[model samples]
Target: MCKQSGTPLQDDLFLEETPTSSVTEKVAKPGPAVELKGSVFTLPVLRLKRSDLGAIEEALSERISQSKKFFENAPVVLDLEHLETPAEVLDFAALCSLLRTLQLVPVGVRQGSAEQQLAAVEAGLAVLRGGSVQETVAAESKDKKTGEVVKQVVVPSKALVIDQPVRSGQQIYAQGGDLIVLAPVNAGAEVIADGNIHIYAPLRGRALAGVLGDASARIIVQSMEAELVSIAGHYQIFEERLPDELFGKSAQVYLQEMALTLVPLR
Candidate 1:
């Protein structure tokens, strides 16, 4: 029997067995060898603050022990902003192997210096670009040769919308934009967006916003009963139940001082 397993939307794969070939049967024509599409995903980022592999292993073990299921086989991106200056020496292969042994998948590295990026590529990781916060400003610039004033504009994608209730096991994503749901989000479902997530109905599942590192993104819900919620990778899980003051009430989830903050929407 063929075995297939993965998350609902991110990596779900379908397979089927091929029938026995026979001369009497019509000749089978070959199909495309592979297909590719562009998609946006929200993955956890592991920022490296130090270059000590021993210390990193110890701290990583402790942190993963606290949330085993959440980190199991989860893809992650390395934040190498700290490794730029002084060019800290890093063992990409060793670090990646360690992450794998801990049941984590290191898919890519972002914001790395030239040498670090080369090292990551040698270690079979993608060199990604969008891990830093972005700013939208109407600023003036001068042409290099002519010294002429020029204007630059930043355009943002429109928010993706769902007009009906999101069922369990369903995953919705709003790439480069916000997300809006007109109905309830059932448990076991997930809604993700690169910007804010606005729900006109109750939220009972997981909602991840600001997946691209927008710290100002927020999740606004009509009724808040979410099992988990995250903004800019800072997350809060409701193990048992929410406090009486916030359970099933209109609420807003945002990031404050690099921490996840929840407040009533009164």
Candidate 2:
């Protein structure tokens, strides 16, 4: 007998071999990458007087009611340019309370007096100086002049139709397109368009046309009781206010040498 040292070499090799299972091989297919485009909307500032808390609240409420969609998830700058009084002279807490009541999230302030800036900082609001505002405006204007084609295109049209009452605290925007309102635009409501804006009903709110530098844009209203009107970036607050003859009647608003003009719509 061959020397059996308690192990059988070749014969027992089969028992010690590890088992393997067959797996089907599959290849993964490659897909194309997705591209995203940027937004085309621009937000405006809410300018108010320091002592006119009631007016501010009312205006904000009207804005909210007019265009809830636009205001959602939007950033805003409060332009305190109209406030001539020192911030120390006004009640910061009261102002905050009024803002809250109007459902306006005040993130920052611009064009405020020195005392106003301090008050804003104390109220935990960012203060954007006039220089900064001018820089931003200039940059935007430069971008427009460059005429760099954006991924998103805005088509211009002559006619539009809106069949709802625009309430205070609401805003409607039709950049690069005409806007037609078949209902009333209540006080505090804002209507903005880069093209013409036509309201067939009472316009007791704010109207801003040619927002994106379209100097030829115009505004036509069947009934004009507007608190403010703007065209081609130039604005007019009816401090003396438009005459009653202009209100409850047809009117047309336009820009003349960058100035705002309202005339009877014959």
Q: Highest TM-score, which number? A: 1
Tens-place lDDT digits, model 2, residues 153-265: 34455555779998998888874478999999999888887678999899999888777657778999998888778776666666455787796789998878767788897
Candidate 1 lDDT over 170-243, as tens digits, reads: 88999888999999999988999889999999999999998777888999999999988999888977767899
Measured with C-alpha atoms, the lDDT of residue 233 in candidate 1 is 82
Worst 10 residues of 2 by lDDT: 131-140
Q: What is the TM-score of each candidate against the true structure?
A: 0.79, 0.45
Q: List the candidate 1 regions with Cα displacement exceeding 4 Å.
A: 1-26, 84-86, 137-155
Worst 10 residues of 1 by lDDT: 6-15
Q: List the pairs of residues colliding in candidate 1.
A: none
Q: What would you estimate as the lDDT of candidate 1?
A: 0.87
